[model samples]
Target chain A: MKKIISVLLAAAMAFALAACGGAQSSAPASSAPAASSAAPGQSSSVAAYATSLDDIKVKGELVIGLDDTFAPMGFRDENGDLVGFDIDLATAVCEVLGVKPVFQPIDWDAKELELSTGKIDCIWNGMSITPEREQSMSLSNAYLNNKIIIMTNKGVTIASKDDLANYNLGTQADSSALEVVKGDPIYDSIKDKLTEYKTYDQVIMDMQAGRIDAMIVDEVLGQYKNTQLGNVFEVAPVDFGEDLYAIGLRKSDTELTDAINAAMKTCIDSGTAAEISTKWFGSDIMVK
Target chain B: MNLSYIATLMPALMQGLAQTLKLFALTLIFSLPLGLVFTLGSISRVPPLRWVSRIYIWIFRGTPLMLQLFFIYYGLPFMGLTFDRFPAAVLTFVLNYAAYFAEIYRAGIQSIDRGQHEAAKTLGFTPWQTMRYIIIPQTVSRVIPPVCNETITLVKDTALVTAIGVGELLKAAQGAVNRDVNITAYAVAALIYLAITFVMTMAYERLERYFSRHQKKEG
Candidate 1:
C-alpha cells in the first residue's frame, strides 16, 4: 500500500508538471487571435491626448518622465537625489519657459503611454528621435548627437561588424541600440545570437560573466558606465547609425514642442547646455 | 482582429513559450526532490538539521521571488559569484519553490497517524523503513493536490524571467506589443496562460480520481 502511494505521488507530480507544459505549448495557437481581436479598440483609447504649452504655463510645472536608472542622462546620485545631464537641461529649459521641472521617474518601456495619457508632460531623458516616434509624438529638434556603439570585453578582439558574427551580443530590449542592431543589414547573419536585456546593467553583468561576448549601447551611456567601472570594457569600431536625443510630447502639443525647441536653443546659445554637458560628459558634446 | 498580424506574432510567442516550458520543467525536476530533502530535514530529530531547514524555508518563503532573482543574478556578482541568465532564473525558482513545497510536504508527513509507524515497527520495520514504506507512501496521496497547485503556479511564474531578460512567453508578447504599438499581443498572452491553467486543472482532476479510487471503493 505504501509503495503504491509513493508511486502514485511521483506519478501525480509528473502528470501535473506535464499537464501545465502541454497546455502552455498548445494554448496560444487556438486562442491568441480571438483575444487580440478585441484589443485594438481598447488600446486606441489609451492614445488620445490634448495637453499644450498654455496648459503647462498655467499649471506652472512641467512633469518630465524619465527612466531614472539611465546613468549620466538621468539617474540617482550617491545622495539618492535625482541628478543627470538631461535633468539639468530640463530644469534649465523649464526656467526659460517660466515653469518648474518636476521629474517623474517612469518605466522606460511605457514612456510613450505615460506621455499620451498625460501622466507626464514630456519624456526628456536620453530619448532617441526615431521616425516611428516622430509619427507618434511631437519631437523637438535633435539636441544631442548619439550613436550606437558596440562594447566588448577588454580581452575580446572585435575589429568591426564582421567580427561580431562570431560573438553572442546583448542589448537593452525596446532600446534604440536594439533597434539599430535589428535594423542593420550587417547584423542579419548573426542576429540569432543576440540577446535582449531589460537594462544595460544586466547586459554588463552578463558580459562580466562571459555569458555574452559583447553589447551594443549608446556612446554616451557606454562611455559613462565604462568610466564608472574604471574602464573594464573597450568600445568596438562598429558604427550602427546616428541616434539623436530629443524631448517627446503628445502629437497635439506642437506649441509646447516649439516652446521647448526655443528653450533648448536658448540654453545652447547661453552656454548652459555646454556647462551641463561638460559637467556630465567631461566635455561639451551638445548639438548646437 | 488582424489575422495576419497575429500570424506574424505566433512564431515569436511560440519561441517564448518554449523557453517558459523549459524553465518550468527544470524548476519542477530539481525543486521537487530538493523540497523532499528539506521536508525530511525539517522533521528530523537532529537539532541543527531541523533549525537549518526551518531557517531556509523561512527566508525563501518570506521574501519575494523577484527580489531573490535580482539578488542572485545581479547582486551576487558583486560578491564574485555570477550566474548566467537561465541558470540564475532556474536557481532562484528552484530555491523559492522548494521552500513552499517543503512546508506542504511537512504538513502531509505530519498528518500520518502515529499508529502507522508503530504498526510498521511491530512488523520488524526499521525507522527508515517505516518512513520509506509506510509514512511517505501515504503522505504522497495527501500532498498531490497542493503539489499540483504549485506546479501550475510555476507555469505563470516563469513570466518573471523577463526581469533579467530571458524572453519567455509574456515577454515575447510584450515585445510584440511594443514593436507593433498594439495591446493585442498581451490579450493573446492572457488567453495562452488561461488555456494552460485549464489543461492543468483537467490533468489534476484525473490524478485526483486515480488517487481516490481505493477510498471510493471502501466508502
Candidate 2:
C-alpha cells in the first residue's frame, strides 16, 4: 500500500511540474505576431504596421502606449479619465496628420513587449530612450529633455547626490530611474541602501511615514504632485542631468517612422505642439 | 528542457525556497498549539466557547485559502492597517491552516471513548487529570495522519503568497519570466517544488512507519 501511494505521489508531482512547464514555455511565442509580415489592404493595416513602414499612410490613426499613473505626463484626472501632457501632444500630432489618436495604457515593464508585438504604433509616455533601447526600435528626435529629481518631506534637505548615499531612496519598479541607480558606477557605494516599490505612491507614503528618507521621480511629475496632491512634500534643488523622451517605433517599420516624423514636424512648425504643451504644462515644451 | 536557464536561476530560486520553508515552519510552529486550544474550546462544556470555536473552525476551513490571503493583503490597506507583504502572507497562512488543524484535533479528542471519562469520574480523578492521562494518549495516534496531510497541503499553498508580491518561489519564477520574456523558468520552478514535496513525502512515510512499528511492539 505504501509503495502504491508513493508511486502515485511521484506521478502526480511529475504531472504538476509538466503542466507548469508547458504553460511557461509555450505562451510567449504564441502571444507575439510574426516579426516582419505586412497585412493586405489596410493603409495602416496590421500587416503594414508589422513589416514595412512605406505601405502605411501618414493620415491613418497611430496608436501610442502610455501609462496613466505617472502624474503630469500621463495619468487619470479627477474624473478618472486619462488626461495629461502626453494626451495633449498626441492629440496635436494626430490633428497634423488628419487622423485620430488612440491611447493604450501599457504596463511599464511590458512597454517593449507592447511595441514588439504591434500592440501600439508608438510609445509616447514619459519613455526615456536609452542607448540599449536604440538597438530594439527606431527612435525619433527627442521632444522633452528632462531629469529625475529627488524629493523629501518639507524642511529635510539633501545637499548633493553624495548626501543621498546611505539614505533609503525609492523609485517605481522597472523604471529607468531605478535602472540608472542600480547600474551606476556609484551603485556599489549605495546599492545596499536602496529599496524599490511597486508604485510611486507607495514610495511617497513611505516618505510621509518616515520609512524612506527620500524618493527620485521625473522632475515634471515631482512638480505636479507638489502643486496637486496637497501634501507637505517639497522638491530638492539638485536635479539629475537631462535625458530625453522620444517616440519609439518598431525597428522594421521605417515607413511609419517617416510618417510620424513628418506629422510631428507639421505639429511643431504650425505651433500646434507648443499650443498643446502650454495647455497642459503652462509653457511651450517643444525642444529642438 | 532549459537546463542552462534553470542552472542560472537556481541560486535565486533556492533563496525563495528558503522563504517558503520559513513560512511553512513558522506557521506550523504557531498553529499546531493554537489548533489544540481551538479543539479544547470546541469540546468545552461551556456553551459559548463551544459555539465560537465551532464557527471559527467552520469559517476558516470552509472558505478558500486564496480568498483569505487576498483579504489580508489587499483588504487591510483600506482599513489604515497595512502589513508588509511577508508578514501579511505568514499571518494569512497561519490563520487559514490553523482552522484545518483544529478540526483534526476535535476529531481526535472526540474519538476518546466515553467510558474513559465516566471511569475517571467514578475513580474520583479530576477532569483535567483524566484528559491528560487517558484522552491525550489515545487521541495522539489518530491525529497523526491528519496532521501529516495538513503539513503537505501547507507546502504547496505557500505559492499563493506570491499574489501579494512576497517573492516566494512562484514569484521568483515569474520575475525570471518577465525579464527573459520566456515561461520555461516557471516550469523549472514547478520541478523544484515537486522535489521538495517528494522529500517531504518520504519523511512522512518514514515517520508513519516508525510510529506503526512502535505500536506493534507495544501491542
The most accurate candidate by DockQ is 1
TM of each candidate vs. truth: 0.52, 0.51
Question: Over the stretch B85-140, how does candidate 2's per-residue lDDT look in tens digits?
Answer: 67888888888888888889888888878998999999998988998887887777
Tens digits of per-residue lDDT, candidate 1, A37-72, equal 222232244344567788888999999987665677
TM score of chain A per candidate: 0.83, 0.80
List DockQ for all candidates. 0.03, 0.02
lDDT of every predicted structure (CA atoms): 0.78, 0.69
Pairs clashing within candidate 2: A24-B183, A38-A47, A39-A47, A42-A45, A53-A255
Evaluate candidate 1 and give its CAPRI docking class based on DockQ: incorrect
In candidate 1, how many Å is residue B97 off? 19
Residue A271 lDDT in model 2? 84
List the pairs of residues colliding in candidate 1: A37-B1
Query: lDDT for model 2, on a 0 to 1 scale?
Result: 0.69
- Model 1: reference contacts kept, as a fraction: 0.00
Candidate 2 lDDT tens digits, A154-268: 7678877777785877887666676666656666876677788876766766776898888888776666666655756777777676667788777767776777788788888
- Please tell me which predicted candidate would have the highest TM-score against the true structure: 1
